[model samples]
Target: MDTTMGASRRRGRLAAVATVVTAAAFTTALTGCGSVDKTLDCVQTADTIADSVTDLQQAVEDAAHDPGRADAALDSIETQLRRIGDKTDSTDVNQAVDDLDRAVGRVRTALRNGDRTPDVGPVTDAAGELTKVCTT
Candidate 1:
């Protein structure tokens, strides 16, 4: 009777340990998944920004014929930036987004000042930085 009671206590201890390990592993996986999800969101938003940048380039070229196109492209890029900002808490990502936002603001300022072909090089450069940060 003593041997049986001791064995049952050992089994219970082992069961508790196993449950703890399983819970720890599950929690670790969930933490990893959060990071992966954040990365995916950043990358997708960066891609969308890239497309908007391309549109901005084209719009700048056609600005004399259709001034509204440039504004539309700028708006789209801002929207994507906002989406990314809302989703990420990473410092690098937030910095990149801020840089991009400033570049966009510069371009918008130039446009409002009546510069039809405002330099979009900064915008492109900032966007490239954003993409790089998102991937890393």
Candidate 2:
């Protein structure tokens, strides 16, 4: 009788350990899947923002010539970037958005000062850096 009780207790402990291990494995898998989704969203947002940067640069050139469209394209870019930042929950995205804002200021200055083109290198570099840091 004592031997049977000992065997039963051992089986119960083994079953309990198996259940805990299975639960832990499933929790890990779920957490990993969540991270994958977040990374995908970050990548998509980065690509969208990069494309918008191109549009904004072209729009700035047009605004320089027309003046009437001065803030229109820039405002659109700002709105899109805000949405991206909201989705990603990334401080890098926020910093890049602010950098782009400053770059827009530079473009406005260049336009008012009768310069043909604004210096956009800093803005490009900042965007690239932010995308790199945030996507990972």
Candidate 3:
């Protein structure tokens, strides 16, 4: 009877350990999925930002016809940047955001100073860097 009890107790303990291991594995898988989701969000936002940057370039090129379109493009880029920024706490990602933000600021400053054809090269460069970091 004592041997029987011992065997039953061992089986119970093994089941408990197995349950814990399974729960741990499930939790870990969930955490990994969450991380992948975040990365996809970031990459998608960066792609949108790239589009906005391209729009900004075109807007500047056609500034003689639509002087206000650049502002709209900048707004779009800023919104996307905020979305990506909110989704991450990575130093590299934040730095990329700051760089792009500064580039946008420079363009605005140029506009304020009566430079409608502000150079958008920096904006493009920063946006490319942002996309690269996001994919990584």
Write the residue-wise lDDT of candidate 3 on 17-87 in tens digits: 33443444444445567766776677667767766876787788788899899999999999998898888
What does candidate 1's lDDT look like per residue over 1-136, in tens digits?
4745644554454344334434444444465676767776677677778778878877887799999999999999999999999999989999999999999999999999999988777787787777777766
Off by over 4 Å in 3: 1-32
Candidate 1 residue spans exceeding 4 A from truth:
1-32
**Candidates, ranked, lDDT:** 1, 3, 2
> For model 1, which pairs clash?
none
Cα lDDT, all candidates: 0.78, 0.56, 0.75
**Top model number, TM-score:** 1
Quality of model 1 by C-alpha lDDT: 0.78
lDDT of 2 at 25: 41
Stretches > 4 Å off in candidate 2: 1-32, 61-70, 109-116
For every model shown, the clashing-pair count is 0, 0, 0
